[model samples]
Target: MATGDEIWEALADFTEQCNNNKRLRKMQRDWTKILHFKAIDMDDSFTMKVVEGEIVKNDKGTVGTPDIIVETDSETMCDMFWGDINPTQKYLRGEIKVKGTQEDVMRIDVITAVIWPEV
Candidate 1:
């Protein structure tokens, strides 16, 4: 299992990469979303806020109701951010679980696909 700090670092790096990608930023333009991630293996939770086209805030604890909630093990979460794992496949195989509307879920998928294509 990955440590909480490692997961945080991966998310920070991933967010920076996404912010630097103009295409990806445009793809998510006007989107304001709050995302909650639960790393079951590490017993850690994080909340991220995406406003306009950038991830503006990421904190160690859940702050409020999220538009999307993602549940997975810490290592898998780290791997996903590192572009070493395919979120779609993991979701299909029950390795990752998500709770959100279809559109919101697809939005998350789109972000992942645009920033970190399957490998």
Candidate 2:
């Protein structure tokens, strides 16, 4: 079981990584969104926002109206951020659950591919 701090750190790092990528920023330039992450294993939630192609993380809570909500175990989330595992695979296997419009979800997939491409 990953600790809450570990999960938060991983998520922070993940967002930072995405924000630092020129390709990612260019791709997400027009896609402003608020995302909510629910760590089922830790029973905690956090928020992240993408605006003007930059990622801004907010503390746990209903910071704003969410465009997408993701639910997954804390360990799985950590692994995904640390590049130890692929989120797309987990989602395909039903391990990670996401609630969002098809377009929104596809945007995330595209972002993930840019950062953590198949390896």
Candidate 3:
């Protein structure tokens, strides 16, 4: 099993690569809703999809999948991940480099901000 840090690293890499993937970019650009999201913090990884406001596990991919439905404690979690920091800007400023959509990048920042209002 992968450690939490390892899982996080992989997710970051995976999303980054997925964002830059020409095919994925083209596909996501035409769609508005995400099918699912899987992510990992440390000890746990999960997958879940939104179905009429209920989150369910339909499939599995990476160990630390980005499913917000299964692992998250609340519905608001969908917007929670991005606000922690302006990771994209940080990356450009030599703080952190991410590998996902600009939308994904901004969402993470939004999550950060919501979670840590003091920061």
- Output the number of the lDDT-best candidate: 1
User: How many angstroms is residue 60 displaced in model 2 relative to the true structure, after the best TM-score fit?
Assistant: 2.5
Q: Order of all candidates by TM-score, from best down to worst?
A: 1, 2, 3
Per-candidate Cα lDDT values, in order, are 0.90, 0.84, 0.38
RMSD of each: 1.0, 1.3, 12.0
Worst 10 residues of 2 by lDDT: 56-65
Ordering by lDDT: 1, 2, 3
lDDT of 1 by residue, 1-119 (tens): 89999999999988998888899899899889999999988779999999987899999989888999999999999988877888999999999999999988888888889887646
Q: Once model 3 is optimally superposed onto the true structure by TM-score, how far is the C-alpha of residue 106 displaced, in angstroms?
A: 25
State the lDDT of candidate 3 residue by residue for 16-63, as single tens digits: 444444544443443332334333333343333323322223233433
Local error of candidate 2 at 53, Å?
2.2
Q: Which of the two, 2 or 3, has more TM-score?
A: 2
Tell me how many residue pairs clash in candidate 1: 0
